[model samples]
Target: MGVPVASGASPLDAHELLRKGEVSRALVLFEKMHDPRRPDPAVLAGLVESRLALGEAHRVAPLMPHLADAALHAPSKDHHTGLAHWALAGLAELEGDHDRAAGHFRSAGEAGPDDPDLLPWRAGLALALTRQGRSPEAVRLAHEHLTRARASGSAYARALALRTLAAVDGASSRRDLLTQALEELEGIQATRLRAQVLTDLAGVLVLLHEDRGPGVIRLLREAELIAVRSRLRPLLDRVRRLLTRLDQPAGSTAPPGLEGLTPSELRVVELAASGLTNREIAGRLVVTVKAVEWHLSNVYRKLGISGRKELPT
Candidate 1:
């Protein structure tokens, strides 16, 4: 009988363990491996994913060149190369380089022609386009992605697509379409989606409410909460500014105490008072878009204001 030799774990095993959050075990096993070139694309991808989860984008950047080279050299194109592009796009998006992000996302989509995972990137590209003032193109791309996402019945993808649609609709002042988009988001139970919907809804309501009274305040407050919970700093900032504008008295010289605002609330309020948008506020505060909204909602409720026009003077 042949004796069985005890051996260390495999790279695939390490990758799986890492996916399950067993980082230490994965590292130990991975370190024991001798051939750097031996790890499969899946293993490499997993390592990249692990690094991303650990918030190490910078570390992941160096691996991309190798990943790209590996993909180009492989006899048959695999999904790994496409995934690398996706990762690059995500990193760019996080860094607020939308143009670069869009380019990478497009490349990823071409690499993985039928990948469902790429839907989010497509939707993101559409959003970026809209933000860049390419409304017609954004709407077209959003509709295309929305059709695919709806057909796939992917809750996450659908929610993202709906948000993109809402953005497009909001830009065009198509309230009915935006309303439908909000309903779609609500159906998905996506709190982040709801935050975005509320923010857009509040903005629309503000425009519709000529008096800018308690009703506007109520909408803004609701939007604020949703944004904060979702860490949507941009929406939160918008809500805050809307609130401050509402609070300003016709002839008042000084801004009011903006009573009931928590520290975060005060921060948002101050930013809003300075006329910053939600996106800008989020960047300045280094908070998620949702967090900004949450604070804004709290601020509105505490002040007993109904509209942006009713904020303390």
Candidate 2:
């Protein structure tokens, strides 16, 4: 049974709960309002997002077919479609499916072309494009979003847009843009955003000072702290690996390929190497077959391998 909300409680309140990291409460609210027969796109999006954050992706993966045609599902509510697309885009990006992320983000924009809330979604598309080896397009898109972010006069949105531009720019320009973003983030509740920028800034600083050893550990350490406190598993894992890299001697850590594998990817690779098929692995891990495939894809890319045959047993 789902927990009931008090009288006058709004769905937006559920979204706020999720944002505030009260994911269980948010899940209760979304589930309480959810109707399986005619799923509310917004509630469905929130449901999946909350479950994913809580490490229960399998529970929601079966519902993905409903979200696959968000526009058709919410024909009368363009914002509902936009919200669903945005949620799916974020999940795709996290899974390293840049093409899918870009496509879904585009769908979001088409759903709500003039919505200010779409600015950050555009920034997400920029990052996805960057990963797909289209840095020029990414830079152009981020710059356009930055202009809109500035015009809107929302420092939080502007900071995010600036961070996107920084991500696509050269190292020197990256530093300047990220610094400007940090300036805008001051006194804001954007802990995740701040941690991300700090991580990027630390990487840029390390690249610029190759002669030095872990001089920017302070920055990365702060990011690590924030990610841990916020329960940002993916970012926390990344920060831990980066921290390991910075702290260890050049030859002390695993090979670059092994080092790059996220904990989730490493687990997938291990299971595959142990002679488990993707379907078996998905069942074992309580994730979707698609999720298992996504992990393998990331593993293959990081390890520079061709396919399942190349994975170590």
Candidate 3:
């Protein structure tokens, strides 16, 4: 049998490296393990982290069944169950199942309130709630997560929590809180975290543009650069749409490609931009879900936007 690492260099060390952003080192350690059956839950979780950091979500999914089964059958109940739920929640978020995502996040939070990862899951849940028009509850829950993250001293958690706070605060017209979120994000150095926060700040700026015009444009441009460099496509799309809307001149003609969209497609785009699901859009448009999906596909092709997140207002 293969022996475990001695003293300070244990599987937990590998997990620590993963948490500290040393992804290559963590992956190397995980690859050297002798037996899959002997793998520490922390090491398995680190593997998940490494894959997620690389944006390999499909790869991460295969491991979820194994991890979930282990967590469910383990002798003692622990944070692993929560981690599994959070992983599934992340997949749901990527698939745009906001309701399911929120449920999973809530389960994760209740199972592992002290887990650093749970803070981000809670923040994500709060953002979903905000998008679903539960602004007051969203604001309250976001602040609660922010408080926990700050107390935990996890920079990643703090950054995500701040982004959620910015979103909720923007929705509730709390400009001062959004300003504070922007200032907090300015000091974070991680590229992915910085890119996400800059995107959130740009969004808040867009909401506040009535009182601050060029200022919002400047922030959006900065966010655009960061997002492009970081290869964060979702945030990049948001920045692009925000800049496009901001740059439209008063009484300007519709752009060339946008002019080709049918009125129904345009309405679908508007609702999609507001975060409505195809089913909801279908109900609003008095059409079948498949019809709404068809319109959205055509709209996406005409607009050259790949994701619903990129739909124009």
Candidate 4:
């Protein structure tokens, strides 16, 4: 039998773990390679990406400039430079700087031309374009990449292309595209990507039905569970916001007596106002009793009431 890898794996091993969504283990391995004297570009890039994926964007901000300089001035034109740029782009995207992200993705493509048959740069560009409101260009680029990915039989590429398409498509087509994307991700070990797909799928489901039907709530709950279990803070925050949004009725403003409360607080107030006890309201809102109590306390304080007995009666 071949020799087994040591407990402390190499940078390649760490990168492979990161790619497979074993981020915590990968971070432990990559941290061992941190050498300021002569930094390994591969290890640096992988560590940065692993940190980003784990929602530690702020933690890695100080090293981004150095990483960018190294990527831009690298000796070889290969995966290291491309990955460095991709990591930078991801950070920019997380910070809500689409322009910077687009520039970095372009630089990545320049550093190492994307494999059109597999993971195409055009696909990433299309997603950025979609966010920038260049839907027509995004659609065209997505079709090109999707066609090539399908022909090449790359499930990961096809899923990515489909998700890009779904983001730019109209509501009707968007639903179908997201559905197909989830199907592609379902068979893979990319748990983070799967959670993202589930979030997008939940968004589409909500759009398709304004009532926050059972199906939509179910999808969102699944996504939320994954985000929480993986400790993906960004996605967890997103899922919570989506849940809060769905809880409110369309064009719903606070009731006349409860005008000052926020949408979420107003929701709890309305549920309670409808004669639902604390336990019932908690169940209806899918929240804990403490959360329900907190909102009720805020509501009582704002309304200048001693108890629920004085609420709108």
Each candidate structure's TM-score, on Cα atoms with residue i matched to residue i, is: 0.50, 0.68, 0.58, 0.70
Leading candidate by TM-score: 4
Compared with the true structure, all predictions reach lDDT values of: 0.58, 0.71, 0.62, 0.70
Candidate 1, position 184, lDDT? 61
lDDT of 1 by residue, 1-313 (tens): 0011115566566655543334433433443452456545444555565555434455567566655665556444446556556666666766788787778667666766554433355776786676667788878988888788888866556656666676775555545555666666554444544555665666666667743777656666766665443334555666677777788322211124543456567667655543455675687568988887777777778877664344432
lDDT of 2 by residue, 1-313 (tens): 0123444556678776665445555666776677778777788788878777645666776667767766556664387788788778867876789999999889888887544434266787888998999988888888889888999877777888888888875543888898899899897666667888888888777777742355578777677766544445566666666667667322212222466766677667655764567996797678999999999988788778899888753
Worst 10 residues of 4 by lDDT: 248-257
How far does residue 240 in candidate 1 sit from its true spot (Å)?
1.8
Q: Which candidate is the best by lDDT?
A: 2
Q: How accurate is candidate 2 locally (lDDT)?
A: 0.71
RMSD of 3: 14.0
lDDT accuracy of residue 257 in candidate 3: 42
Q: TM-score of predicted model 4?
A: 0.70
Model 2: lowest-lDDT 10 consecutive positions:
248-257
Candidate 4 RMSD to the real structure: 13.7
- Clash pairs, candidate 3, are none
Q: What's model 4's overall lDDT?
A: 0.70
Off by over 4 Å in 4: 1-8, 116-120, 248-313
